[model samples]
Target chain A: MISTHLPALQIILPLLAAPLCVILRNGTLTYWFAVVVAWLAFAVSALLLQEVNAIGVIAYKLGGWAPPWGIEYRIDLLNAYVLLIVSAIGALTVSYAKPSVDQEIGGDRGYLFYTAFLLCLAGLLGVTITGDAFNIFVFLEISSLSSYALIAMGRDRRALIASYRYLVFGTIGATFFLIGVGLLYQMTGTLNIADLGERVAAVGPNRTITVAFGFMAVGLAVKAALFPVHAWLPNAYAYAPSVATIFLAATATKVSIYVLIRTYFTIFHHDFSFGVMALGDIFMVFAVLAMLAGSAIAIFQTDIKRMLAYSSVAQIGYMVLGVSMATVLGLTGGMLHLFNHALIKGALFMAMGCVFYRTGSVSIESMRGLAARMPWTMAAFVAGGMSLIGVPLTVGFVSKWYLLLAAMEQNLWWILVFLIIASLMAIIYVWRVVEAAYFMPSSAGAPTDIQEAPMAMLVPMWVMVLANFYFGIDTKLSVGVATRAAKFLLGDAS
Target chain B: MEWPGLYNYWIAIFLMVTGLYLVMAPQNLVKKIVGLNVFQASVFVLYITMGKVTGGTAPIIAEGIEVYSNPLPHVLILTAIVVGVATTAVGLALVVRINESFGTIEEDEIRELEEAQEDAS
Candidate 1:
C-alpha cells in the first residue's frame, strides 16, 4: 500500500517541504530541509522505478477518484526513468547548493531560494508523474513561476532582465500549450491522457487536431529551447545563480522533452503524428539546425557559462534528432541521451559552480592556469568536457553511438555526417575552455592564492563526473532502461 | 457559413493574434506584460466558448435542467487564471527590479546599457 502511494508521495513530500522551508527562515536550516527532502524524493523515485519494473504500469487515482473523472499518477517505464533522472539531479544539486548559495547569493533570501528550489523540484516531478493532460500545464506553470524567482535571485543586475525575458517567452509558451489542450478537450471531452489518446485516435486527424498539434509542438519546442526559439536560454542560464544553472541545465528541458515525447507518442498515435503530419521530418530539420547553430554560437561566447548554455542547445538537438529518427534505435538513443546528457551537463555545470565559488568569475579568459591552482575542479571539468565531446569511455559516447546507429539504420548518411560534425564542434567549444584552464598562463592580475572548491562541492561534482565514465563503460543500467522505455513508447503506435 | 456559430472562434482568434502581436512588437516591458495578459485572456474565452451548449443553462442541480453547459473547462480556466495572475505579478516585480537597477524599463535602453558595459569591460 505504501509502495502504491509512491507516485503521490514523490511530489507531495517536496511540495510540503517548500512551504516549511520558507517558515523556517534560517538559511542553513532551510538548506538542510531541502537536502533531506530532495534525498527523500530521490529515494521515492528509486522505489517507484523498482515497483514499476517489478509489476507493470502503476496507476494511482488521486483522492481515490476513478479515471476519466479525476487526475491519475501513471508510472510506466518512461515516467519512472524520467522521474529518476530529475530527482537524482535534484538530490545531487541540493547537496552541492549550500556553499555555492552562500557564496553567490548572500543575504536572508537563502530561505526563499530553497523554498523556490523545492517548489520547482515538486513541479517537475508532478509534470513527470501525472497522467492528466491539464495537470501537465498546471505543473509546468508552477515550475516556470518558481524558476523565474530563482533566476532573479542571482546577484547580477542582468539577472533581473534575464528572468524577465524568460518569463515573457515562457508565458507565451504555456498559453499556446493551453490553447492546444483546450482544443483537444473540445474535441474529445476528456482530460485524462489515456482516455484522450483513445478518443483522439477515434476522431482521427481533423483541422482542430492538426492545429492543436501545431500549437503544442511549437509551444513545447519553445520550452525545450529548440532552434530559432531558444533566445531566452543562454542569458537565463548564464546569469542565474550557479546552483540554479546546474539544476535547470540538468533537468528542466529534459522534462519538457519528456512532455513532447508523451504528447507525440502516447497521446497521438505515431501514424497520425509522424506519417500524416510529417512532424518527424520537421523535427529533423530543426534538430540539424539547432546542432549546427547552437555550437557555432557557443564557439563565440567568452563567458564559460554562456558557452555551456549554447552547448546545451546543441545537445538538446542530439536528443531531438534521435526522437525524430522514429526508429527503435533512434528513440533509444534519444532516451539514453536524455539520461546521459543530464549527467554530463549536470557535472559540467557543477564544476563551473565550483570554479565560480573560488575565483568569482566564469569567463574563459579568467580561467587561465586554473589547472595549476584548482586542480581537482579543473580535472573534473576536463572529465566532464571529454564526456561532452562524446569521447570513448564516456556516457556521451554511448548516446552518440546509438544515435549514429539509428541514422545508419535509416541510411541517412547526411544525418550521420552532421552528427559527426556537431561532435567536432563540441570538441572545439569544450577545448576552448580546456586550453584556457590548462595550457594558457594565468593572467597577470589573476589570483594565485585561490584555493580549490570545498570538499562538499567537489564530492557531488566528481560523483556525476565518475558516473559519466561508470555508466559509459557499464551500459547495462542506462542503456537497458532506455531501450525498454523506447520499445514501450513505440508499441501500438503504428 | 453560419456567422453566429463560428463568430466566437473568430473573436478568440483575433484576440489571440492581437495579444501575440503586442507581445512581439512592443519595446516597453510593462506593455509586454499587458500583452501577455491579453494573450492568456483570449485562451480563457476560447475554453469557455468550447464549454457552451446552445440553450444550455448553468450546470447546477435543478428539477428541470435537460441541457447543462460543461463545467470542467470553467474549472480549468479558474486554475489557469490563477497561474496567469501569478505570472503577471512576477513579471511586474521583475520589471520593478529592472527599473531600480537600470533606471529604464525600455528593452532597447537596457540593451544599449549592457552593450556599453560589455564594450567598456
Candidate 2:
C-alpha cells in the first residue's frame, strides 16, 4: 500500500509543493500553501514516528528498486524523531514567516522568499529521511541552495556579502562531504549507506576509508558550526532577515550534527569511532573548546542576533561532546541535547523576531527597557534563555543532566568540571542580555512605546517557549524518543 | 589503462579541487559562482564515471549489448546540477544587489565598509 511508505511522503509532499509555491506566483497564496504543506509534512512525520515506535525500521525503495542499487528512504527511530522535529518547526516557522516576510521583503520578492523557504524545508526533510550516502549530499545542496537565496533576500545590503561568504563556506563543506562519499565509493564500489557499512567492514583498515572519515568529520564540523570553523555562521544569521535566521538557526546545523552522529557511530561503527586517532578524546577536546570559546565571544557581542549565533556554536559543542563519549548514555545525551537545544533556541529565535518586529533593530543596546515595553516577548526570551542556561525546570536542564550523567559514566571528571564551567559562562552571557532588557535604563527616553508584535508571531513564539517548558517536565516525547533513537544508533555498535 | 579507465576519476578529482579552490580564494562574487559550477560539474563527472559498465553504452531501453551504464547517479546528478544552477543564479543575483547597494563588487572593500560602519556606530 502506498500509505505504508508515509515517511517518503513526509519529504515528498513539500518537495512537490516547493515548485508549486514558485509557479503559483502569488506571495500570500504561496505563503499559505507552503505553511499547509509543511504542516502536512509534519503530520506525516508524526505518523511515521508512531509507526517506527511500534514497528522496527521502515525502508521504502524508490521506483520499486531495492537499496544499494536504487535510492532508498529509510526511517528508523533516529530519523523519525528528526523528521518530526524538522517538519514541526518548519511548519510553525512558515506560519510565523507570513507576516514577518510581508513586513520585511517588498511585495515582488515575497513570493520568492516563501518559495525558497519551502524548498529549504523540503531539502532538510530529504536529508533527514534518505538512506543513501550520496543522496545526503544531493539533499544537502537542495537545502544549502535555498538557504543562500533566503539569506540574500534580506533588505540590508550587507546580506548579499554575508550570503556570498556563506556560499563559499557552504560549498566547501558540501565539497568535502562529496569527496568523502567519493572516497568511500571508490573503496566499496557502492553508494548505499548500509551497503557501504557492510563493505567498509570487509575492507577494515583501508587508508582510503580512514581518510574519507576525516573529510566527512571536518565537513560536518564546519556545517554544524563547531568553533574555529564557524566563521560563516554569525554574520549569516545576523544579516539574514529574522525568519530565515530563526528557521536555519533552529534546524539546519542541528541536522548536520545528526548526520555526523549517524556517519560516525551508526555507519562506521564504534571501532572506527574510537580507533586510530583516539577520536573520543579529540571530540571532547573540541566540544569543550567550542563551549568555552562560543560563550566568551557571545558575551561581548552588542548585536543580539549575532550573540545567539555564537551561542549556537557553543550548544553544538555540547551535542558533539555528548556523542564523543561513545557510549549509550553519551549518545543519548548528545541526541537529547540536539532536540532540546532545537526547542529552546527555536523559541529564543522566535522571540527575537518579535523584538525585531516591534523595534526593527536587533542591537542589544537598542532594546533597553524592552521588558517593560514588550513584556511577553521579553518573557519568552527569558524563558528560552533560562532553558539555554539549563535551569532546573527546562528542557535545557534535562539535556545537561543527561550529559553530566554521561560524563560521570565515562569517569571523565574533568569533562564534568568543564561542563559546569561552560554553563556558568552561558549564565553570564544570558544574564547580560536579560539585565539589559529588564534593568538597564530606557535608552529610547520613554521606552519608545513599542507595542507587542501581532498574534501571528506571538502565538507561535509562546507555543515554542511553552513547548520547551512542557517537554522539560514531560520528557516522554523528547527523552523517551531520543533514548530509543540513541539505542538504535549505537545498538549495533554496542 | 586507456583514456577513460582510472583517468576519468583523476580528472574528476582535479576539477573538484580546482572548483573548491576557486570559491575559497576568489575576491569577486561572480568568480565564486563560476567556481561552484565547476565544483558541481566535477561531482557530475564522478557520478557519471561511476555509472559506466565495462564496455557499456547509454542506458537506453533497447541496448542490444546488454551493457548499460547505471542511470541512477546520472538522474541524481541531474537534479543536483539543477540545484547547483539555482544556487549560482541566486548568488549572482545577490551580487547584483550588493553592487547596487554598496557600489562595490569586491569582498575586501565591502568588508572595509562594514568594519568602518561598525566602528562608527
Candidate 3:
C-alpha cells in the first residue's frame, strides 16, 4: 500500500526532515538526521525509478484529486532518471557536508545549513516530480530561496554579495517563468503540463504563446546559467561554502536544464519549437558562445573554484548543443550529459571540497606542491580533471562521443570542431592546476603543514570519483536509460 | 490591438518594465529589494488580471450568480505573494549583514572595497 505512494513520499520525506532538523537544533544531531533523511530519499527515488521502469508513467494525485483540477505528480522515464541523479547527489553531498561545514561555517550555524540543504533537496525533487506548471514555480522558489540562504552562509563576505546578485537574477528568472505560466493559463485555461501539451497544439501559433515561450526560455536560460546571462554563477560558486558548491554544482542547474527540456520538447511540441520557431538556431549560437567563452575565461582564473565554475558554464554549453540538434541521439546525448556532468562535477567539487578542508584556500598559488602533501585527494582531483577533459576512460568521453555522433548525424561538422576545441580548452585549465600541484615549488606564504582531508570527506569524494569511472566503463545503465528516456520524451509529446 | 479592452495588460507591462528598471538601475541593496518586490507585484497583477471575467463577481457560489471570476489564479498569486514577501525578508536580512560586514550597501562602493580586499590578499 505504501509502495504505491513512493512518488509523494520522495518529496515529503525530505520536506518534513528540513523542519525537523530546525527543531532538533543541535548541530551534530541535525547533521546525522539530515544524512538519514537524505539516504532514505535516495532509496525512495531508487524504488520510484524501478516503479517507473516496471509500469510506464506514474501519476499520483495530490490529496486524491484528479488532474486538470488538483495538482498532480507525474513521473515519466525522463524525470525518474533526473530524480535519481538529484537524490543520489543530495545523499552523497549531505553525507559529505558535515566536516566541510564544520571547518568553514563552524558548528553554531551547522543546523541551519542542514535545514537549508534539506529544503533545497526537497524543492529540487518537487520541481522534477510535479506535473503542474505553477507548482514548478513554487517549488523553484522554495529551492532558490533556500539556496540563497545557503550561499550567504559562507565565511567569505563576498558570499553575501554573490548570494544577493543571485537573488536578483534568480527572482527575475522565476518571475519570467511565472509570466510564461500566466500567459499559458490565459490561453489554455489549464495548469497541468499534460493538459497544456494537448491544448497548446490546438491553440497553434499565436502571439501570446510565442511571448510566453520567449519568457520561459529566457527565464529558464538564466536559471540554467546559459552563457550571457550566466554572470552570477562563477562568483556564486567561488564564494559559497565548499559543501554548498558541490551540491549546487552537481544538481541545481541540471534541474533547471530538465525544466528547459520540458518546455522545449513537451509543452511547445518539438515540431513548433524547433521546426517553425527555429529555436535550435538561436540556442546553437549561444551554446557555441558558452562553450568558447566559458572555457576561455576559466583558463585565466587564479581561484580554482571559480575556474571549475566557468568550466561548468562551458559544460552547460555541451548539453545545450546536444539539445539544439533535436534528434533522438542528440537528446540522448543531452540527457546523458545531464547525468554524466552531474557525476563529473559532483566528483570534481568533492575533490575540491577535500582540498578546501585541508588548505584554507583554493587559489592556484595555494595549491603549489599539494600533490606531495595530500596524495589521495590530489589523485582524485587529477582523475576527475581527466574526466573533465574527456579522457577516453571517463564518463565525460562517453557523453562527448554521443554528442559528436549526434553532430555528425546532423551534418553539423562545425559543432564537432567546437566540441574538440572545448575539450582541448578543458585540458589547458585542468593542466594548470595539475602543474601547480604536482610540479611547482610551494609558493611563499602558502601553508606547509596541510594534511589529507579526513576519512569522512575522502570516502564520499572517492565514491564520486569511482562512479565516474564505473559509469564510463559500464555505459549500459547511463546510456540505456538516457536513450529510452529520450525516445519517450520525443514520442510521448502530444 | 484591442486598445482599452486590454488595459490591464498594458498596466501590467508598464509596472513590470518599471520594476525591472528599478532592479537593474539602482545600486542600493535596499532599493534593489524594493525593486524586486515591485517586480513581483507586477507578476501578481498579471496573474490577478488573468482571473478576471467580464462582469464577473467574486468566485463564491451563490443562488443566482453565474459569471464568477476564476479563483485559481487568485490562489496561485496568494502563494506567489507569500514567496515574494519571503524573498523580501531574506533580501533585507542579507542587506543587514552586508552592511555590518562591508559598512556600505551601495553596489559601487561595495565592489570597490571588494576589489581592494582582493588586491591586499
Candidate 4:
C-alpha cells in the first residue's frame, strides 16, 4: 500500500512541507523540516527507482482515472533516474544550507528561504513525475517563481537585477512552452504525453506541429541555458545566495535537460525530432559553440561563482552534444554526463559556498591562500575541478569517454577534436582557481585567520566529492542506470 | 490561404510580437512587466481561439447539447492565467525592491550604478 502511493507522496511530501516551513517561522525548525522532507523525497525516489527496475513503467493516475482522461504521474527509467538526481541533491543541499544560508541571508528570512527552497524541490519533482504536458509547465513555473525569490534574497543589489532578468527570460520560455503545448493539444486533443505521442504521429507532419516542436525546443533550450540564449544564467548564479547557487546550478537546468529529452525522444520520436526536423545538426553546432564560448568566457570572470556558472554552460553543452548524436552510445554519454555533472558541479558549488561562508566573498582574489586555511574545502574543490577537466579516473572522464566513443562511432573527427580542445579549456579555468587557492600567498585584503567551514557544510560537500571518485570507480549505479535509461529512451531494448 | 478563417491566429501573432518587442526594446522595468503580461495574454487568446468550435456552445454538458467548445484549453488557460498573475506580482515586487535600492528602476541606470560600485570596490 505504501509502495503504491510513492508517486503521489514523492511530490506531496515536499509540497506540504513548504507551507509548514512558512507557518513555523523559526529558522532552525523550518530548515530541519525541509531537510527531513527532502530526505524523505530522496528515499521515495530511490524506492520508485527500484520499483521501476522491477516493473517496466509505473503509471499512477490521479483521482483514479485512466490516462488521457486524468493527470498521471508516470515513472519510467528516465524519470526515475532524474528523480534520484534531483532529490539526492535537494537533500544534500538543504542539509548544507543551514550555515551557508545563516551567513549569507541571515535573520528571520531563513524561514522564508526554506519555504521557497521546498517549493522549488516540489516543483522540480512535479515536473519530472508528471505525464501530462500541461502539468510540466505548471510545475516549471512553481520552481522558477520560487527560484526568483531565492536569488533576489542575496545581500547584493545586483541580485535583484539578476532575479529580474531571470524572471523575464524564464517567463518568456514558459509562455513559449505553453504555446507549444496548446499547439499540440490543437493537433491532437489530448494533454497526456503518451496519448499525444500516439495522436501526433497519426497527424503526420503538419506545419503547426513542426512549429510547435520548434517552440518547445527553443523554450527548453532557454531554460537549459543552451548556447546563445544563456544570458540569464551567469548573473543569476553569481549573485544568488551561496546555497541557492549550489541548488539551482546543480538541479534546475538538469531538470530542463530532462524535459528536453522527454520532448524530443518520447513525445516527438527520434526520426521526427532529429531526421525530419534536422535538429541534430543544429543541436551539434550550438553545442559546440556553447562548449567553446562558455569556457572561453569563463576564463575572464574574476568572481569564482561566475566562473563556475560559465563552466556549467560548457558542461550542459557536453550533455546536449551527446543527445544530438542520436546514437545509443551518444545518449548514454548525455545521460551519464547529466548525472556526473550534477555531482561534479554540486561539489564544486558547495566548495564555493564554504569559501563564501568563511571570507564573505567568492572573488578569485579573496581565494588566495585559501587551501592553507581551509584544506578540506580546497581539497574538495580541487577534486571537483579535476572532475570538471575530465581527468582520468574521475566521473567526468567516464562521461567524456562515452561522448568520445559516440563521436568516433559517427566518424566525426572534427567534433572529437573540439571535445578535446574544450576539455583543455576547462583545464585553463579550473587551474586558475587551483593556482590561486593553493599556490598564491595570501593577498593583502584576504582573510588571514579564517578556519574551515562548519562540519555541516563540509560533510555534505565531501559526500558529493567522494561520490565523484566512488561512482567513477564503481560504475554500476550511475553508468548502469544511465545506459539502461539511454537505451529505453532510444527504444533500443537490446 | 483563407485569410478570414485564420484571422484569430493572425491577431494572436500580432499581439505576441508586439509584447515581445516591448519586453526586449524597453529599458524601463515596469514596461517590461507590462510587456510580459501582454505576451501571456496573447497566449491565453490563442488557446481560447483553438478551443473554439464553429457553432460550439459553452462546455457545460446537458442533454440538448451536441456541439461543445473544447473545455480542456479553457482549463489550461485558467491555470496559465493564474501563473501569469503570480509572475506579474513577483516582477512588480522585484521592481519595487530595485527602486528602493538603486533609486531608479531603469535597467541602464542600475547597470551604471553597479559598474560604479564595482569600480569603487
TM-scores of chain A, one for each prediction: 0.99, 0.97, 0.99, 0.99
TM-score for each candidate, following the candidate numbering: 0.99, 0.93, 0.99, 0.99
Q: What does the interface RMSD come to for each candidate?
A: 0.5, 1.9, 0.5, 0.4
Question: Candidate 1 lDDT, tens digit per residue, A14-65?
Answer: 9999999988999999988999999999999999888888898999999999
Candidate 4 lDDT tens digits, A1-494:
78899999999999999999889999998888898999999999999999999887999998799989899999999999999999999999999999988878885789999999999999999999999999999999999999999999999999999999999999999899889999999899898998888888899989999989999989999999999999999999999999999999999999999999999998898889999998989999999999999999999989999999999999999999999988999999999999999999999999999999999988988989989999999999999999999898899999999999999999999999999999999999999999998899989866578999999999999999999999888989888888899888888978
Inter-residue clash pairs, candidate 1:
none
- TM-score, candidate number 3: 0.99
- Go through the candidates in order and give each one's C-alpha lDDT: 0.93, 0.85, 0.93, 0.94
Two-way lDDT contest, 1 vs 4, winner: 4
lDDT (Cα, tens digit) per residue for candidate 1, span B21-102: 9898989999999999999999999999889898999999899889989988999999999999999999999999999999
Question: Which 10 residues in a row give candidate 3 chain A its minimum summed lDDT?
Answer: A485-494
True contacts kept of 2: 0.67
Per-candidate DockQ vs. reference: 0.93, 0.56, 0.86, 0.92
Q: Model 1 misses residue A114 by how many Å? A: 0.6
DockQ of 2: 0.56
For model 3, the stretches where C-alpha displacement exceeds 4 angstroms are: A492-494, B1-3
| Recovered fraction of real interface contacts per model | 0.92, 0.67, 0.74, 0.87
The residue-by-residue lDDT of candidate 3 on A113-142, one tens digit each, is 999999999999999999999999999999
